[model samples]
Target: MSAPDPKTPDDDPLVTQARLRRERHERWLREGDMSIGRRLAQIGVLGWIFVAPTLAGLFIGRWLDARHGTGIFWSAPLMLLGLCLGGWSAWKWMNSR
Candidate 1:
């Protein structure tokens, strides 16, 4: 890249300064995007997302099991498995993004 025209700075000094600051801040944020707390929160959120269906199944299955007498025989477990699969899928999706 060509050196900055120090003699005249950029065509717009304020715009240049803002651009430089934004780049620097982005670098800093990227460097620290994931800390222990952040990681824990991420895990918590992912778990919640994954388990939502499971919990819903538990309730709905229980209700249906009582109404239909199936005991949610498969829904609960299936939903639990979905939790893990959902998390894995999310990871894959994020990586692709």
Candidate 2:
């Protein structure tokens, strides 16, 4: 096979710049420098994670109240417990990284 062509600084500027930009982006991703949009999305995910269990508890408690004829007695405590559990779960997720 013939020898490969030598590369020089005189390479096309556009190609060089594109390659450099790609490298920089790869480095940023590797370094875990998430973009603002991505960070916001993650925050949204965390918010959902924190809210789902609480809402579920509320609904379930409401069902129990309807069944057992109890007022806020069951709903209130369950809601609080769900809130605490969700908060703990979210905290663990946030800190796990």
In terms of TM-score, which candidate is strongest?
Answer: 2
Q: On a 0 to 100 scale, what is the lDDT of residue 5 in model 2?
A: 86
lDDT of 1: 0.71
Check candidate 2 and list the clashing pairs.
none
| Residue range 21-66, candidate 2, lDDT tens digits | 8988899888977789999999999999899889988988888998
Over 4 Å off in model 2, which ranges? Answer: 1-29
Per-residue lDDT for 2 in model 1? Answer: 95
Q: What is the lDDT of residue 19 in candidate 2?
A: 90
* 54 Cα displacement, candidate 1 (Å): 1.2
Question: Per-residue alpha-carbon lDDT of model 1 for 1-97, expressed as tens digits?
Answer: 9977565546778889899889878988888556799879877876776677567756665676678777668567766766666677667746653
Clashing pairs in 1: none
For model 1, state the Cα shift of residue 83 in Å: 3.8
**CA shift at 27, candidate 1, in angstroms?**
5.3
Which candidate ranks first by lDDT, i.e. highest? 2
* Minimal lDDT window, size 10, model 1: 88-97
